[model samples]
Target: MKDIFTNLYNKVIGFFQAEKGDSSKVIASNRLKLVLMHDRTNLDTLTMQKMREQLIKVISRYIEIDQEALDLNLEGEGDAIALMLNIPVIRARTLEEIEAIEKAEEEELAQKAAKDAEEQEDAEGSSDESEETEKNTKDSDESGNAEESVISEEEANTEENLQNEETNETEKQKVKKK
Candidate 1:
């Protein structure tokens, strides 16, 4: 039946296919150990110190690290050398935390802008009120000056009438004496 043919097909495929495991990792580790052993045997202490400094500088760009407690070593045994590195991070912020910080900054900026706008409006309003007060004072002063001029003219007319009456009385007395 169909089941028997399927089983035979699977068996034939399994017989020809190779097994899969950590063979690539094993090969990489062996090659790394051999290369490190050969290179570290001839590398001077100054060169290793330089390498450690460079590594620290490169790794510090992405995280807050404790450089004073960092460790870098090249351990060798027989013909095998292992390069090891350990770096301690102070804190790792997730995407949400970073976004929260950015949001807080934006809110602070918006609040400051609103406060500045309010202050500016108050200042302009006060300036406008002062201008209106000055205009009102000028109008009152002009009306007071007009009233004073009219009162002075009336006093001058009254003085002229009193002089004319005095002259007429003197003429009548002269006519009676004649």
Candidate 2:
């Protein structure tokens, strides 16, 4: 395309126009190469910038780095693309410190899991106790109904016996009067 030809022309012109020992020319050429690589790989500028930032953040966690001097680029080698990163490190984290941080995080997660499990168990236990209490109440209600029925039957029998005794007494009085 016309754009490709223009880019090639610019690169050639820029190379010839560079003075000896000019670092700016090298920087410009590297930037152009990065642009070309991004175009070929279907990667946009924003995505490349975000990737750079994330890489810096992750690497900085283990080492103190000179952020201003970091360089990241993608280069083509035979049909493959390789990512190159150059970072100036100030200091690296000691193994003991990293291990301690990891141990603390793991302990915190374990404590959280234990708390969640305890809450679940408590919920289940309370529900089970409520069910048992309800069952006991139902059983007591059924037994009370049975006891009430038995008491009513005993009262009915006593009333019948009293009526029979009164009728006998009335007949005996009639016999004595006759």
Candidate 3:
């Protein structure tokens, strides 16, 4: 009785000691439960039952299987998730079936890898293009600034020449007056 009381006391302490900042498994399980309810029943549990029955029927056509042992599990894999179809088939399988399954999985993985490579290449290409464009823009801006400086210098020289001409004209007018 004392041991049971001590154990209960420890459990209560553990519950209180749990970090409040992190979400607990109970919270995640509750969220998943809400999501999975829709998957399990489309407002009609009978329809979902029919679907499971039909799925087993389709799979059994190709292989000798134990329907009772079959499991359809859905779980998270990182941010993504997967639907696992586990059908218990007889140990006796044709070379063709094994080969077919292997070929399909390989093809799927290869396609995913190719898509990833293509996306990576596209991202790199866009980054390189953007960097080149930025450099070109900066170079063009610098060239434009240099041209403006040249134009200002020319304007200043023209103004100085006009001032000299005015001075000469004034000197001539004074001589004429004299």
Q: What local distance difference test score does each model get? A: 0.69, 0.75, 0.67
lDDT of 1 at 10: 85
- Rank by lDDT, descending? 2, 1, 3
**TM-score of model 1 vs. true structure:** 0.29
lDDT tens digits by residue: candidate 3, 89-171: 77644778766766777898999999989867776878677667768999999788667656655664575577668888999
User: Candidate 2 — what's its lDDT?
Assistant: 0.75
Using Cα atoms with residue i matched to residue i, what is each candidate's TM-score against the true structure? 0.29, 0.40, 0.31
Counting only residues 3 or more apart in sequence or on different chains, how many pairs clash (N, Cα, C under 3 Å) in candidate 1? 0
lDDT of 2 by residue, 21-136 (tens): 44686768877887778878988745665676789766875787877556667897667888888787888988886676667778989999999898677768786776677689
Candidate 1 lDDT over residue span 41-143, tens digit each? 7865445555766886656544557765566666778766677787778976567766666677689899999998986777687867766776898999978
The TM-score of predicted model 2 comes to 0.40
Give the per-residue Cα lDDT of candidate 3 at 83. 56
Off-target runs (Cα >4 Å) in candidate 2 are 1-31, 99-178
lDDT winner between candidates 1 and 3: 1
On TM-score, who's better, 2 or 3? Answer: 2
Best by lDDT: 2
